[model samples]
Target: MDVRLFKQVRAACNASTEKVADGLVGTIVEIGGDPLTVRKAKDRLSAVLQKARNGVPQLVGGPKKGEEMAVVISVRDLAELVVAARQQETLGEALDAIGFKPYRGAHILVGQSRKRERLKRSGDAPSAATAN
Candidate 1:
């Protein structure tokens, strides 16, 4: 809600942090009414924010059907969160397609043939030579 917080969200967006995209720090403001669902309220609120065309935090989720639940999140923060969510989904799909079942620490696959040549000269494996 503060200017500083918005800046932080922008920075996270640049870094592509997923936590922000998942509405981790956003607050949900509930609106009570008759014959109106939470999802509808949320949608209406989102529309209003978008029309305003300002840098204020915006609504993420819609009002729930037959209920009242609206979520308000910083636009910048939401962007970062969305980026994180999408990246995870993409990575998962790629791994599944390749039948990859990782069972240990992350495997950092770096292409360093030139470096490997240098390491061979120094009588060391690529990893150890890079350490030097």
Candidate 2:
């Protein structure tokens, strides 16, 4: 509906995670049965976006749904989710493939997994203890 508002919502969702990680924010205590923490973070973002759609003030919710509990997410979680959804493609392409025709002139944030930080396995790199 409100394209500009949607952009704000997306940015807010991404920022919410940093706040949580820094102990500056909290999330709703009532878990929605999603064991995966990543999903939980995404859900929180979704809730925030939903509230925005409903005319509720974005970030109005609290960490525990106290009147308005905003979701807590991390940069890693959001990036991973975006990558999984778009997979080296842009948001428009992904939407087109999924048959989601957005509102004319609506601008969706293009998701592109251009780079990633790889986790080195124990055997992949020699530690000081392992090195002579």
Candidate 3:
């Protein structure tokens, strides 16, 4: 993707909520379908792809209600999303290294086992014997 489009995608990915990100990602052509609509979409696939390349994503809903939806975006956008996802994974790893643990979908600083041991040794925290 071009620099501008990449920036926009990055911002969208970083948005706190998916609903907020949807707005930042630009136009979304939602295809909620019947068989005829699906046929039409197939015939216009090239045009839809071109639109996606230009940063307008297509959200194709599943055949049945309450099923998952699929998004059609350019390969470049897909690559950027992969990179963003990896970055998030790396961030989670780093946070874990620094004594943060995942708690209820968020990270909480619960000091590492080694740190807890040191604190116990230094009389900063109660020992197991004392707790009982």
User: lDDT (CA) for every model shown?
Assistant: 0.45, 0.44, 0.56
Ranking by lDDT: 3, 1, 2
| Model 1: per-residue Cα lDDT over 14-91, one tens digit each | 344555544323421211112224456455865545532443443433345544234444566467545543443356
Task: lDDT for model 2, please.
Answer: 0.44
Residue 40 of model 2 has an lDDT of 50
Query: If scored against the real structure, what TM-score would every candidate get?
Result: 0.25, 0.21, 0.40
Decide which is better by lDDT, 1 or 2.
1
In model 3, the Cα lDDT at residue 116 comes to 44
The sequence of per-residue lDDT tens digits that candidate 2 reaches over residues 1-132 is 223323333334335665533332222222222222444546676775554344333332333433434443444444544545344246765575668965798587988877878889978998898788
RMSD of each: 13.2, 21.6, 14.1
Task: Identify the candidate with maximal TM-score.
Answer: 3
lDDT of 1: 0.45
Task: Put down candidate 3 lDDT per residue, 4-123, tens digits, no spaces.
Answer: 444454445445676544543333322222222445558888976786787666665545765545666788777876675445336765585467965677676796565443325465
Worst 10 residues of 1 by lDDT: 27-36
Can you give the lDDT of residue 11 in candidate 2?
37
